[model samples]
Target chain A: MAEDCILETSGLVKEFRGFVAVNDVNLKVRRGHIHALIGPNGAGKTTCFNLLTKFLEPTRGQIRFNGIDITREAPQKIARRGIVRSFQISAVFPHLTVLENVRIALQRKLGTSFHFWKSDRGLNQLNDRAMELLTAVDLAGYADMVTVEMPYGRKRALEIATTLALDPELMLLDEPTQGMGHEDVHRVMELIKQVSANRTILMVEHNMKVVAGISDTLTVLARGSVLAEGPYAEVAANPLVIEAYMGTEASGLASIPANDDRPPGPLPGEGDDHGSLRSNSGGAG
Target chain B: MSRRVTIAYLLGLALLLAAPMFIYPILVMKVLCFALFACAFNLLLGYTGLLSFGHAVFLGGAAYVTGHALKVWELPTLVGLLAGTVAAAALGWVIGSLAIRRQGIYFAMVTLALAQMVYFLFLQAPFTGGEDGLQGVPRGTLFGLDLSVDINLYYLVLAIFAGSFWLIQRTIHSPFGQILKAIRENEPRAISLGYDVAKYKLLAFVLSAGLAGLAGATKTVVFKFATLTDAHWHTSGEVVLMTLLGGMGTVFGPVVGATVIVTLQNELADKVGSLVTVIMGAIFVICVLAFRRGIVGESLALYRRMIGQKAG
Candidate 1:
């Protein structure tokens, strides 16, 4: 109920049949802070994000955004309320030009979302702004190119650019740097930091360095419940947080010591450790 | 790019102006009516990615309405056409709301089932004259100009066809059309961007249905009768064939497809009547196997390739 909290969830619960995917939990994200949600595999991180975005209905609990109840709002309705989200998979309109992908998002703010009678040529006015967002993400030169032709990492950047076009007050990023190269991870991490200025971001990330490097607040969920919540350093040193992650694969966790700068290598399905690293399924926690 | 489209438009206009002097006006009018029908159907199928297998309900249902208005109610030609168009639009809104609940093939099947219901309704409806249909529909004067003559009727049909076709082209290039394409390509992404996808789909359905109704109403005036054949399920399949054969996404594709299919039907009616469906089936197969993009799509790709080669 704090005035500074932009997004607050109380007793959020989601159950799939009989199994509870996201158990009762409360989360509050302060305005203008980079908050990261991290947990091991099957930790109900995605389910929680889906519940917040209204993509999946919660079995119980309420979510308040900007002091308004948004728990019953439609996904698009919540998006209109300035809480926009990006998918874990690069979610770009593959057939549309990169410029068009961004322009469609911008069109919503201009009140032209349902203007079927007007020529799309009138939308040329938004091109300059779309280009600016694309340029910020280093995609200016590829504006006219179809999104499918863009490289993997660049597609993720395009997704960020499209999300940024919404000018969201509370951006929910689902694994911003999920599948990327080392250089791409660094570039996207920097891009996220640049965009995070003057905006509140709640991201579900697995990359330790990206989270530790940028996140002002961290919330770790294990087995459908919050295990630790605090500043990155405090949560990173939390004994329970370390055990929850280490109990999974340990390879990605073992590399990150108590006070080390070198973050763990790419998580599952990223690069070299793709097939070798499996998402830990059976979590008793 | 606009210049090229304008040139094509002007060329098409010139060809149409010269057509009635040589070919039969009635046949050409038939082609134009079917062409518009196919184009309207493409708006939903190609642009919105929602296929309605029962689209003939709009076309045939409008024909019956217009025919009844002209023969029974004795309304003016324009007024009857307007009534038919409104009726079809209302039907589209209702059917689209129900059909949009399901997706892909399920949507198509729901539409098909709805069309069958409409078909039986018309089959027994008193105003539609049952199997005999509404016969001897009067083609009244248009703004003081008489349309009883074949040449006069031809020009009026031509005007309506061109005007409706232009409206459809404008709709496709509109901001609303862009949203339809966005939803077609990636629906969840469109939703994430705060679009009410259901509303857009329903609007498109209504627009397409209104235009298809316009085509049907005009066809009644041209033919002087509204028959069971117009509302038959076979008519739905034929429009799909025309749109697919000419290219679903291209603007001129439906016209080309309708012309080809209608011409084939006319030519084969007397010589090889029974084989017409078989030959049409063969063409469909060939188009699907070899030119899946349809005629216009293939040509456009070739043109783009040639331009790319020259630039490279």
Candidate 2:
């Protein structure tokens, strides 16, 4: 069972000054599974992602990847160890062409990323592979286009393509479909599903459809701790998870599919609770 | 390179070769030295997105080292230049290691503070000759060519400048350069892609510093002296102004910027005296206000727009 888990965290805690952002999270992501980490606005999903990637040091805890402790490793070292993460915001190099963005990721494998004396013409060798990755994300036509001029949804797709170029054993995606139209969201979900073959993906997602449609396993967090962990269907029906998502009086667990596209409306006596959730997410941004 | 750009470069080189015939060779040499220095500064500022406020440390520090080697150690000109370049690169490594820990304005402050320390060390150091400056340094022979002659020395400076310029161009377009652009565009993204961002930044700082040192050493050979003015904060500020005036990121922008500023100072010194400072300041203000993309950057943008319209 231990060998089956690709990434595991035990007693992982993160605090900002005196305030605890993540408190004693114990997580296990099984190998080759599409694991989704989902919660309400202030549930510390982003903070957990930061700790897993070592962008923020945990106040107390241990993180293991393939049975080796990686709690103290640098972000780049973790990435080199096959944990590549995408950003909540689109992370493409704005001035570079779409092809160049993917090529940069592939260039690391050539071991010439530090060779300043050599002509970049050698990097032309990477163009075919870069184009292949772009083609995977349906960005082959936009290869020559500067990334900043790309539409918002296309930029997210580019980010995914760039991430895929790394060919990581485990890919962590933060809010991959945060802001998108229905068409783009569906396209990206399909892209994610297509790319998940033979690779493990751990994603922090807000869209319930994206979470419910693709995730093989789900972990629900509330107030920096795991409230429920199971299949999406099972976690959705957990009474405590329902209360954490709505209030105690809420009986709308079955309507989760319908309410997934929009924020759940303010239930009676839950007005202040909903308002605070909105404000917390806004402030985090 | 584009056909248009290659042609422009060839034409520019021809003009430079013919320049000494009409303009004073020493003045043109001075411009070349400063132009190279500005270009080195631009590598860190424009391409890598590091605004080093203490670049004059490398420039002036190398000048002093080259001058000392030639006058006191009696080393060959090439050796003296190499020694100076290596010293400045070492300094850059130290400074960059510390400065890259911070970002934006804080990074600038760290470089500035360290440069001030080096300035004071040079000011009081016995080898630098203090306020008297390192004077009467010989232009030692290179390949048995007597560089004492201005024309011989001018050609040497031009060769050095052209080589360094080519190196910078190659670096800006190399695999390393692509990483640098990626780092500049999005540092965190670069890191998440498994790049040790600090290492790249430090390497860039060292390269930029070494090139600046080469420029300084060449200037010392041309003028036969090294002065306190080279290491001063004002000189550091001047390089920033030159880079901004010409175009911060574009190739050839700093060269044009350095030429204009150096020529203006040379031309105005006799007529305006200290008011040249005020006039330069005014030009800087106007540049920041109206020509933020700078002379070369703006022209390139306009050219692209015209080409785009034609294609459309």
Question: What TM-score does each of the candidates earn?
Answer: 0.93, 0.95
Write model 2 residue lDDT over B51-93, tens digit each, in one string: 9999999999999999999999999999998888888889889
Q: Score the docking of each candidate (DockQ).
A: 0.73, 0.85
**Alpha-carbon local distance difference test for all models:** 0.87, 0.90
lDDT of 1 by residue, A100-215 (tens): 99999998777776776777898899999999999999999999998999999999999999999988998999988877887798889889888989899999987776776678
Query: Candidate 1's fnat?
Result: 0.79
| Best of the candidates, TM-score | 2
Output the worst ten-in-a-row residue range by lDDT, candidate 2 chain A. A271-280
Model 1: docking quality category: medium
Q: What level of docking quality does candidate 2 show? A: high
Question: Candidate 1, which segments miss by more than 4 Å at Cα?
Answer: A1-3, A247-251, A254-278, A281-285
Candidate 2, residues A81-127, lDDT tens digits: the string is: 99999999899899999999999999999999999999899999999
